[model samples]
Target: MKRITVSLLLFLFLVTCSQSDIRHNQDLEDTTYSIVEDKNESVIRLSSLTTFDWEKAFLFSPYSPQEMIEEQLDVDFKDPSDLDMRDDIYLLVFLNKGKVVQYAEIERQDADFSIEGNLTPSNDGINIERY
Candidate 1:
């Protein structure tokens, strides 16, 4: 009787541990995002920004450029007509709660490029930085 009880407790502990690990993995997968180069155009495509719960959070709350790239925008750069298309070009894009878009070009080194910043909304709009 004692051995049987011990074995049952051990099994339960293992099951609990495995369940926790699975939940952790699911959360990691939900938050993962990526950027891929568009082969047809001279542009990069940002992907996986529309996962369910995170999208709702992004649409309602103030987030960073990194968070936006990892959670919200789903734009494709088909025509580089208005863009400078240089390797050194950096852009700050603002998207309002209404989904309106605005942008500004900044002179910065290509090596200094990153997709991280706090993108709080103001009277102007929801602001984000892009490299």
Candidate 2:
């Protein structure tokens, strides 16, 4: 009975290890952007803007701007217009065919900040940089 229990535990361990390995491999294969950390900030670069979801990347990120603002300033922004009025912000640089098209500077003080831009392909490609 002890031998059987040991064998069952070993089987479960192998299964868990294999599942973790599969997930790690899938994440490496599915990653579309690269993140670089520099001192106090991180830079996210995307080869194509079409695949970039700003709302998901920023507003819903692990360290969301909204949560940061609320924690630091004790203020909340409910409207899009309110974000534009703030001073403490981060920048999103947009490119079309590797050329700069538009940019947005999002204030960290705002609870809900949205990025607006023309993501359509004007030349042959699209790229984005978020810092």
Candidate 3:
């Protein structure tokens, strides 16, 4: 009887741990945003910034000849989606509840660049979609 009880408790503990891990992964997925490329244009897309407590959004282009940085974008996504991606490469950063959640690296090629996917920012970076 003692061995059976111990085994049952162990199984419950394992199940609890696994459930917690699953929840954590789901949370990450929920917070992800995406950027996509369509013929001659790149669109910044997200589910809903306010849903994740997103506080800030910004875009910076390091390769541009002139300093171009867009700050304090609409958290509710009222801002324009077609950003002026004049440089070959760019970085899009998003703050979720005062923490950096995105480091999306975007690249544009002539007019042929194609992009699509979940643009959610993570430590590994947000996925950029090209079309």
Candidate 4:
């Protein structure tokens, strides 16, 4: 009877461990796929822009220095009347014809920025088809 009980306990432990491992792996795969999907979408949208440049595309906080932003885009930060200085992160993009686009709700960690699961065409960027 003791032998049978020990074997049963061991089997249960092994089963539980395997199940946990499966769940962990599944979570990792999902996260990886989500990152990849975001990256691919960003590439597609950026490629559609007629005057997109890698050097000019960057992340900035609302509190970032005005000089930094103005220098990067080579445009004056005129503080447009329609612009609201919301406390949030943004992606500054420069386009042809002296157009500038700002994508909001960007995620920032120290100096790193991530758009994963945050991009929406209507809110974050223009429709690729129209651009």
List where candidate 1 sits over 4 angstroms from the true fold.
Answer: 1-72, 75-85, 109-118, 122-131
Clashing pairs in 1: none
Query: Where does candidate 1 have its weakest 10-residue lDDT segment?
Result: 50-59
**Deviation in Å, model 2, residue 88 alpha carbon:** 1.2
Those runs of model 2 whose alpha carbons end farther than 4 Å from true positions after fitting are: 1-87, 110-131
What is the Cα-based lDDT of residue 71 in candidate 4? 70
Global local distance difference test of model 4: 0.39
Local accuracy of candidate 4 as per-residue lDDT tens digits, 53-111: 22233345456666666675575443321123544334344333343443223322222
Which of the numbered candidates is closest to the native, going by highest TM-score? 3
**Candidate 1 vs 2: which has more lDDT:** 2
Q: Which window of 10 residues has the lowest lDDT sum in candidate 2?
A: 21-30
For each candidate, what is the lDDT? 0.32, 0.33, 0.39, 0.39
Residue-level lDDT of model 1, residues 15-50, one tens digit each, is 555333211123222222122121222222122222
Which pairs of residues collide in candidate 4? none
Per-model TM-score on C-alpha atoms: 0.27, 0.21, 0.33, 0.32
User: Is candidate 2 or 4 superior in TM-score?
Assistant: 4
Order candidates by TM-score, high to low.
3, 4, 1, 2
* Regions of model 3 farther than 4 Å from truth: 1-37, 40-42, 48-53, 64-87, 111-131
List of clashing residue pairs for candidate 2: none
| lDDT of candidate 3 at residue 70, scale 0 to 100 | 28
